[model samples]
Target: MSNIKGKLIALGGGDDDVLLKLIRSEICDIHSHIEVIATATTEPVESGNAYKEAFEELGCSNVRFMHIDEANAADTTDHIERISKAGVIFFTGGDQVRLASFLNSTKLLEIMRRRFREEEIIISGTSAGAAIMSDCMIYDGYGHYSLIKGEMKTTHGCAFIKNVFIDTHFAERGRFGRLAHAVAHDPEYIGIGLSEETGIIISEGNQVEVFGPGVVTVIDASNTRFSNTREVEENEPIAVEHLIMHLLVKDYRYYLKERLFQPLTQTMPKEEAGNVALPEK
Candidate 1:
């Protein structure tokens, strides 16, 4: 398991063509299989079909849907076997809480984690699916209300990355305050706000690079000097000091290990020179 490495793509909701193509090229070939899990979505059948069509259109011939609508379904031997053989496992958007509730601590999730650690597979998701990739997930919270104490709710996630707190449809939904609240609660964690149609690719070493047609906002509160989270009453606005933020467009790279941002021009590898094109501006 220590020698095996994989990739994780957390996407904000909407338009995943480029990201999917990249995943296919990196992890799949003509013979590789891709599993689309739509347990997080209310209409799993429809969502599954949609992804199946999309993947097929991308020339992925071995794409199948794994329907796990309940906790009991997650433990089925068939589901576990499908996951074990998949080159890619993709989760669809619905409700983060729903996904976590059934999948958490389940045998299926354990198998997925094991595959992620010991095999060369890609684990990707959008919207609520993206939120479940973190150790602490934002289950409930809205725009401005999230600025107040006790307005946000969080729960344990799939634990793909513990130090990152992910929020999808960030700017479009005005979710900065919610993500900020989570960062204020635990400054040691890095808060990632992904806008619609955007995503971040996190390598095994925690090297992250932004992609897509929108921006990715990063909020770092590790060096904060003050916060009134503890003193503020419920529903009261929080006051924090010295929180750092960075906006990243396509090609910008970030390292979670060192908490640093590297511009695309400086970090782009020579081998990938022409291959890395800037997202349409």
Candidate 2:
């Protein structure tokens, strides 16, 4: 039910170029007049520092680093204040399970919801950082082809994009199958498959744009061809149907509101098109 829109960059895995560019753009191009507050989860201050320094190098000021894991224990109001104030919030990926457990329902979570409303809050993370953005997240697994039952586990996400399930490092790990399984079971959801070093930018109006070097795959089930999801038993080879997949490269945009994919046009004239043609009896 959160209306505030933001940008999402789900990298396939490895590569810091796009992430750094996003940080610079969010801080310099967009929120040029706001303050920058940076923080990390816990135990891996090195990664957090790397992210903070990268942004700082781009001339972002007032950078504040919080030991979120240790400090977030007592209450969330403090965490909320720190997260909400910053112009951009960067989450250095470490352990998604730990991050979810700590932030779920906390004041921090509420602040994140508010930050998106008040200002242009850019949430970028790597590895585990990217996994927590979706309602159904792919955690603790390698890729989609390894159909080992229960190898990839699904956990609670920040619910930012409620309908879609996001998996990063997609092509690198061959994760299309894992996302397909999720879609097969419930064709109502959209699967966002981001490749390594790539990112997806969701504008204020929920328009999804693909950025970076690799590809961003969009699996839409609303008009899905078919899925043998229900036919197979649990943990079995999902009988997948003809899935409508859109593989987007750099600079392409997917507008969620229009329901029309940009730059790729498939033609079906009025006679054969479903909308303009009449049903023959």
Best-fitting candidate, scored by lDDT: 1
Model 1: runs farther than 4 Å from truth?
1-4, 265-281
Worst 10 residues of 2 by lDDT: 272-281
RMSD of every candidate to native, in Å, equals 6.6, 5.3
Give the alpha carbon lDDT tens digit for every residue of 1-281 in model 1: 12337778888987878667877787647668889988888888899989989988888899999887853378888888888898888889999988888889888888888777777678899998889997888877788998989988888999876778999989988899989988888876889999988998888736788878889999988777888877888988999998889998887887675677788677634454234221111
Number of clashing pairs per prediction, in order: 0, 5
Q: In model 2, which regions exceed 4 Å deviation?
A: 1-3, 29-42, 70-77, 141-151, 257-259, 264-281
The stretch of ten residues in a row with the least summed lDDT in candidate 1 is 272-281
What lDDT score goes with residue 275 in model 2?
35
Candidate 2 TM-score to native: 0.81
In order, the Cα lDDT scores of the candidates are 0.82, 0.63
